[model samples]
Target: MRPQALLPWCLSLALAVPLVGLTPASARAATDYQAEDAVISQGTVATNHTGYTGTGFVDYTNVKGSYVEFSVSASAAGTSALTLRFANGTSTDRPMDLSVNGTVVASAVSFPATADWNTWATRTVDVPLTAGTNKIRATATTADGGPNLDRVSVAAAADTQAPTRPGQPSCSDIGEDGLTLAWGAATDNVGVTAYDLYEHGNKIAEAPGNATGKALTGLAPNTTYDLTVIARDAAGNTSPASLVVDCTTKPSSDTTPPTRPGTLAVSGVTANSADLSWGASTDDRAVTAYDIRSGTTVYQTVTSGTSATLTGLACDSPYTLNVVARDAAGNTSDQSNSVAFTTKACTTDGGVPSSIATLSTGWTIPWGTYWMPDGKTALVTERDDFRVWKVTKDGTRTQVGTVPNAVTTNGEGGLLGVAVDPKWDTNHHVYFMHTAAEGNRVVRMTYDGTTLSDYTVLLKGIKKNRYHNGGRLAFGPDGCLYVSTGEAQTPDLAQDKNSLNGKILRMTTDGKPAPGNPFGNYVYSYGHRNPQGLAFDRNGRLWEAEFGNSSKDELNLIKPGADYGWPTCEGSCNVAGMTNPKATWNVSEASPSGIAIVRNVVYMASLRGERLWRIPINGDNESVGTPTAYYVGTYGRLRTVTKVPGADQLWLSTTNCDNNGGAADGSDKLFRVTID
Candidate 1:
């Protein structure tokens, strides 16, 4: 019956084991199932199948009167969980209620649809779990009569104990290197503790019972050994020793030099010896000089620009030369493809600047850069971490003022995009986009170059999604402040002009939208995903760069009352009413964030692609230019791009550390761009 019902009795045996069809168990479990907590989407699932399989399932047999309860506890108490393929369905999509301890913790009426299972799909249910058995009851409810508990299947609790070591025998092979081993953990009422490792079945090392990870290190290189570990529990009950795992250490570091290049050929040959050279390579990440042999005698070793000449040999006298590439680490690549050829005179290419030079002084997360009326002090937005910086022409950086209660340090939630008050030197005003306690807000910081004073809260309460708040504050030539916002994953908000989410709001120095916005002059434009990077040229045209998760990044020129489709469309909108991007980037090469117009070109900063691009514009809301690849691999990430006062230099910020996984030590740097 019930396939032997794989199970064990916890502390509370609740002996009332009801038969499958004995009672009408619908009244007590249906109505009480609040869809608030049953959505446990973050647990581990079995990944052994070619596609996806589940070690976890929902049970609906224990339902009563519009409510469902768990046999013991909720899903969180689980130490190990079942993982399904991302293409699989959602927890609630199958009509399930997650329960633990006769209480419904999480329930879902509708499963949120998504392709990526990492970000939006992990819904934490509200129910709590105890230290015993757990069950998730999935039941349905009918308004008129009844038909909800149709598909009911119960999943037996998972067994975390390690299987017994099958057929223990004798292993005598041993090596110099340290040993590598692995084993399964013991099952438990809750979870197992550390695992005790053994050599020759004797206690050696103790590893954590966490199954998702492994441990192997310390010993002689190139050695072999047998190892095994026993899963131990906090309660002192140990599982059988797992089967022995055999492993070997790595071989000695490869350091042999490559063979010499042979078979030199003549191509584009001339009377004068053609320049001869071999390809360059690095060994162990180090590059050593190349050894060249002319005839039977040995030639000098060249560090760079492979290929040496044959001098003092009779004109056109056949000669054999070999080229070998070596590295500083004493490791060399295979000899390059052999080439037989004559000597060629070398020529020089003229005049490349030692390297492009730009002034990066006074730059600290300068999302927005502009010159005060006097053109002496450059006002750049310092973001929330650095606020506003008042720097003189000589590169003196000073803080304007900080917005109190700022600093989100979470995904795109923090102080971002900044703009100078159209009349900065005259009116002493500055504006910024920051996350307040409530939500994303656009505020103004008032200051006089020397002593900054007072912060004015202009706009607040805009919808804030962790990763996409669309922060790019700019002041149009009309002297109106523009704040771009994100949709917060709520698709409907993008089309709702009245809602601040997914919109570009044009407001006065204070928080009120400009007097003449599209909707009663309150909302500037609607329908945007996450629009960052905004700028207006001398011609008074606004352009913005936006980030799309899987699609192309866009360089959009904002038009009043126009909709840059968000949830409805990504790029190249074939939809009836949607705006298209002026230019689309692959996101890898250009997640364009901050933009600055200079010398009739739009210099936009790329986030994922740490480079600055100068797109030439023709005043037609479009641009063309050869994107200059800079800091190429030098800086891990780039965020905001802007132009300096002289009009020839550009500025951008690196966001490696800001996004986590980045080194905290000076990994984030401000780069200066000078256009030659």
Candidate 2:
């Protein structure tokens, strides 16, 4: 039977049917199976929301294919009513596929909102079941995942049989900290769910039900261990332990680091790329990797060979680099003698500066600028004062409103990044990213061409710090909102896919994870240190600008779900699974903040470089041409650069009033730069 929502009718039916299903004639005794007691995948038992039955409800992760399976039994083959209690707080419907015994009975079953998460409701569906054990599964069909599931009520029995003891386990490929453990599979009446490996009575590792082997790691070096395996079924039944196997880890004897690399030489130097080769280092056991360093910080790691290629280098730049050797034991050798080289000069495209005219003045650290759909006015955000202004194409400015609950980090965080919805003419919606009391947030506000109102938070929980609080937003050609976030000064967070910080997020206007996202979350790309600039080229491809740690700043062509290799690579690298930048500048030459595209050329504004970098997008749309600097040292700390909607010009803002500039309040000015 198709599922139907139960609200008032379910409450009355539950009170009136207390004794209705107590006999076999009435389809056996009705039993309530709590979702937390069932086998859950890609979900968690959560008590964050109230009004749930039993201990807690299953909070499914925001991803498709997440499910909760309940093993149930029946007295005979017959049709039974399955009543599932859930809570959906979102306005959008969360749909799931309901299956019985691995066969789908209902596809895309709608679970509508129950006002709020605390409010509970029910949906009943009738399905045929086998006399033996049957599995009832609800799998999410949308990226938003299933709603909070409380329990499933039906007349069914529970499985209680345990699996047989696992066969004797054997060890192989033993190492200093890990080993491979294999065992014979165990049988169960209902089927085994997993096999857990134990060491000294403590569970250490687990393998899937169909597997008889697992790799165990994190063991002590040169230590002997007594390990056994125990099989478990879906009903939480555990079998007797298998025969124990004793093993010893390899000794940690290698202590010497690899010899320093020899004869580091640079050859084939181009404007944007270089090739280097070095003598291989020797180690006591094995030299695992080689690190290429610029000054002191390592720029890239070479895992297999002594020759490497470095791309994305700035034109006409001088570089001093060294090499270090590393062994498998994590020991590092001293730096090799440095090699200094100067890249070839750039061939200028149509990127030469024509004229720069002051458009607006008396502003304080204008951090972001986005044009309105009408192309006659633009929205501008002040980083320190949290003020948003409306500016005309003719340089007329008006104080529209201030973002609420915006707190300053006293450094780079305050009110940053303003994006107008593509449908702003109809929705009057505008989005902003700012620092708050707890963290950073993306909020939506309403503007009716006169004032801003109706402040509402769309997304939050991005950590913020005094520095590295990357706040940049733009609307993609697909009508999705894109946000750039920093790692909050925590370098490791950049590499973590689960963290919202140090990520480029793509979401809907409602702040939901955009459809077709790679990780089934809001993260579009990860491993970014402080990505502050986001722009779309003529081909709708995304281009980004990021601040490097100490060595290089980067310009990247963004791709969904690609890893940019933060905390590991600074600029170009030879690492696998990590994307290299299209162009890179020395940290002193470009602490790029905001970027804009005009006529297939990307204009990057630099804070520390005090210059505007113009790089032409190659015809292939994958790489950038040689970069040329404009207005060097003329503008004090350039901050934001925005393309004029229908003109070959850019609206550039200065950040001279910021902490880095140390200028007086209202010292910042806005200028219009015409491309030749």
lDDT of 2 by residue, 1-676 (tens): 3223212221123233221111111124677999999999999999999989899999999899999999988766667788899999999899999999899998999999889999999998877788888999999999999999999998544444568879989999999888999999999976888987766433467899999999998776677887878788765556756777889988766768888888999999987678989998898888888888776555557898899987645566677889999875567787888889987876655444467899999999999999999999999999889999999998999999999999986567899999998788788999999999978999999999989999999788787766678899998877778999997755556776767888999877776776666777778999899999999876678999999876789999999999999978989999999999999998767889999988788999998878888888886458877776666566779999998988889999999998668899998999999876
With candidate 2 superimposed using the best TM-score fit, by how many Å does residue 292's alpha carbon deviate from the native? Answer: 26
Q: Which stretches of candidate 1 lie above 4 Å from their native place?
A: 1-366, 384-386, 619-628, 665-667
TM-score of each: 0.48, 0.52
lDDT of 2: 0.84
Writing each residue's lDDT as its tens digit, candidate 1 over 22-107 gives 11111112112222233322222233323222232222222333343324333335432211112223232433444454555545
lDDT of each: 0.54, 0.84
What are the runs in model 2 whose C-alpha is more than 4 Å off?
A: 1-351
Model 1 global lDDT (CA atoms, 0 to 1): 0.54
